[model samples]
Target: MRRICVFTGGRADYGPLLPVLRAVQKDVALELRLLVTGGHLVGQQGMTTERISLDGFRVDEQVENVLASDTPVGVAKSLALGIAGYAEALNRIDPDLLLVLGDRYEALGVAITAALRLLPIAHISGGELTYGATDDSVRHAITKLAALHFTSTEEFRSRVIQLGEDPERVFNVGAPGLDNIRTMAFLSQHDTSKLVGVTLKTPVITVTYHPATADPQGSGRGLRGLLAALDRFPDVTIIFTGTNIDQHSLSITKDIEEYVRRREASTRLVSSLGQAGYLSLLKISSAVVGNSSSGIYEAPAVGTPTVNIGSRQDGRPRAKSVIDCGEDEAEIAAAIDAALRISRDDLPGLSDTPYGDGYAADRIVHILKTVNLKPLSCKKFFDLPDSYFYMCSNQRN
Candidate 1:
């Protein structure tokens, strides 16, 4: 049996990986192991570690690395702690392959340790660019470190190849989040309204704004602009998910709480809704308004409109379903106004997601089961001579 280890650290990363994790569990040829860490341990967002237990998955390891402090220094120190914890746990479990998703520093830490141990690494969602939060750099770095790549879209697959990875090693499977959409039968409009404690008969908006805490001034400016816009639309009820645990996230969290407390408003702000509840919210929400990639990638699948504000998702591929706006109050308000006007009949037809079709788990499992792990290696760009460029078919030199 091929032993495979998958790591999940935060709610944002976990939302995309849960479906594949389940598939890994059911694969007969695979000994699926789970490594849990980061935000899941913190009680802020329901402590997903407990949720994992409730979901019935046996946890193989829990590495505590997140510091209580929220600063760049804290993030740097946390990376070191994560690498140490993962290296030790990996030595004990010693899976043949290590699987990781997305661009969190914690995921990068584990991937680096796996590479050092000469274990084959299967990385998902690599090569996609997210210009916000330094996640773009971390994602590309993981792409170079991993031996096998499972990209969510064709664009991402081509990017991995351009980065010198062998084309045969990369597979473009649809976004795994879409799998949850395809498989889970969401509640009808009536049930969803009851779940969120709001009436869905009117316009419903879903918002997920994570701060770019890496910046010194703090990243709540965009959230402030969005809040100002939301204030203008008192007719619509909004659902707000908490920000990821980055350097300034705590401050942003406090700001949001204070804003909600000060205003006796019609909106409901939540710390989190699990994968199921969040997806159900997507199904019923008239438009998803936020800086999250979920608005860019997952909303279209259910014909949900998206108003994506700010630079967080600057370089990623998006569908016509999205309206890109800036952090300015007026621009954000205009985008929200446009989004509210988008009727259900006018919602973008479910486009073939650039990310994938919801079947990444099977492809990932197949590669892990069959690939040779002995010669674990990364891609290196060749430096060809200028004189030989004419003779070479490739575009080097």
Candidate 2:
């Protein structure tokens, strides 16, 4: 059996990796080894490793690498710690292949360690652009290190090829997170309200803001603008999810805490809602508001509109349901107003997303099962034809 070691850093990747992990574990020809690290181990991030176990997947290894501070230097030190911890874990597991998703620094550290160890990597969600955060560079870096690429869209698959990865080894498997819309039993509005300890209200909005590391002002300014915009709708119930463990994340969290405290009756801050609860909330929400990629990828899949704030999700393919705006209070408020105007009757069409048909995990598993791993250790950069650039130029016109 070929052992596939899947590396999950935190909630961000874990939600998408869940179906992939389950597929790997259930496949007879594959052995699943899960290595949990980063925000999964951080208490402020909700210790999501427990959620992994509760979801019935066995944690094969746990690496505590996150530091108490989220400063630039602190994040760098944490990356160093991650590299060291992953080195030991990968040496012990020594899987036939390393499977990692997204562009988190922790995932990059894992890829680096695996590359040095001569372990082939299969990367998911590669070749996507989040121009606002440093993840754009990190994701591209992982693509070069990986042997096989599974992209969420054909455009992303083309981008991976543009990055010099062999097109033959790249597969467009759609977004695995969308698979949850089909497989999971989502909670009802009443159940969701009970789970969140808030009464069901119309025009409900779920907010999940992470630090846009590219922003010099950090996430606070954008978050403040979002809070002020949210205040414009006094009747709307706002549910805020935890901030990601990135630089400036602490200040963002603290700000959200204060904002929620001030508007206790209408706003609630939930550090972690687990996958089902969160998705369920999205299903019942009037709109998902934030810079989170969830608003870009999953909200539309659940027939909810998204008010995407700031540049954090810029360059990513978005459905028509998404309304983008700058981090100014007026801009955000206008976007929220536009998103709220999207009627329930209009949402079904918006659910037709570019991501996929919810079979990404099955497709990913089939390829992993059948793909020849012998040639993966030796990668050859596939240069684009001269005419390819010409075609791109023509399209630009």
Candidate 3:
């Protein structure tokens, strides 16, 4: 049995990995070494660690951090702590392969440590571009470090090969988030409202905005623009999910609390919603207003219109239901206006979401269970000279 260790540090990554993790757990040939770290371990997002155990998966290891800082300096120190923590954990678990998802610094920390230990890594969602955050760089860096790639789209697959990885190693499976959409049981609007402890509002909006790590002062400015835009829809019940913990997290969290407090009657700020609740809320929401990839990837599956603000998702593929706007008061407000006009029923047929069709997890599990293990731990880039294939064909002729 191959000891496969999956590392997930945030809800954003963990929720999507659930399907694949479950598949791995049931596979007779695999030993699922589930490594929990970062945001999933912290109570910042509503005690996800407890939820993980409740979900019935046995946790293999819990990596801790000594630093609680959110500044760049503090984050750097955290990375140092993560490297130390992960290295020690690996020493104990000693898995044959490491699985990492997304581009968080915590994910990067594990990938770096795994690389040092000569452990083969299977990276998901690599080669996608999100120009707004330093995630673009981190994603690419992980792509280079990983031995196997499970990309969400064909476009990303080609880009990964262009980065000099063997094309055979890159598999274009659809986005794993689509699997939750395909399978999860969602609460009805009334039940959802009751579960959330709020009465149902006709035109509800769900907003999730993370810090634009590219710009130092951009988080506050962009958030203010979002708040000002939402002011126009005073009657709308806006459900806001907390931002990812990053260098600018403290400021974003503070501002969101202030925004909710000021608009207390109409706004509710939730830290984490398990996959079912979150997706169900999106299903009934009039618009998902934010720059998060969820707006680009998952909102379309639920037939919700998305008012995507600013450059956070600049180069990523988006469905037609997604309305792009700048972080200006007028632009955001206008986009929200257009979003409100979008008929929910018409959304399913309108845009073609390039992400996936909800079967990514099976493909990921198949690869993990079947792929040969030993040679993958040590890899070499097959750098072929330009026109070498053509020349070889001519010589053969």
Separate clash counts for every candidate: 4, 0, 0
- Tens digits of per-residue lDDT, candidate 1, 160-250, equal 8777787778888867777887777777777766666656656888888887644424356677888898888877767777778887778
TM-score, cand. 1 vs. native: 0.92
Across 1-397, the per-residue lDDT of candidate 3 in tens digits comes to 9899999887889888989988899999899988888887666677687778877788888887625777889888888888899999988999999999999888899999999989999999998998888889999999999999999999999888878788888999988988888888888998888666577587999999998888757666778899888998889999998788787888888888998999887788888877778889988899999888889888988889999988889889888899999887899999999999988767772236788888999999999989887878888886756786688789999
After superposition, which runs of candidate 2 have C-alpha atoms over 4 Å from their true positions? Answer: 349-351, 393-397
Query: How well does each candidate superpose onto the true structure, as a TM-score?
Result: 0.92, 0.97, 0.95
Candidate 1, which ten residues in sequence have the lowest lDDT sum? 212-221
Q: In lDDT terms, which candidate is top?
A: 2
The root-mean-square deviation over C-alpha atoms between each candidate and the true structure, in angstroms, is 3.0, 1.4, 3.5
What residue runs in model 1 are displaced by over 4 Å at the alpha carbon? 189-201, 213-218, 263-265, 377-397
Q: Largest TM-score belongs to which candidate?
A: 2
Ranking by TM-score: 2, 3, 1
Q: Write the per-residue lDDT of candidate 2 for residues 138-249, one digit (tens) a residue.
A: 9999999999999999999999999999999999999999888889998988989988878869879999999999984745678889989988999999899999888989
Full candidate order by lDDT, most accurate first: 2, 3, 1
Spell out the clash pairs found in candidate 1. Answer: 152-355, 174-356, 174-357, 175-356
In model 1, how many backbone clashes occur?
A: 4
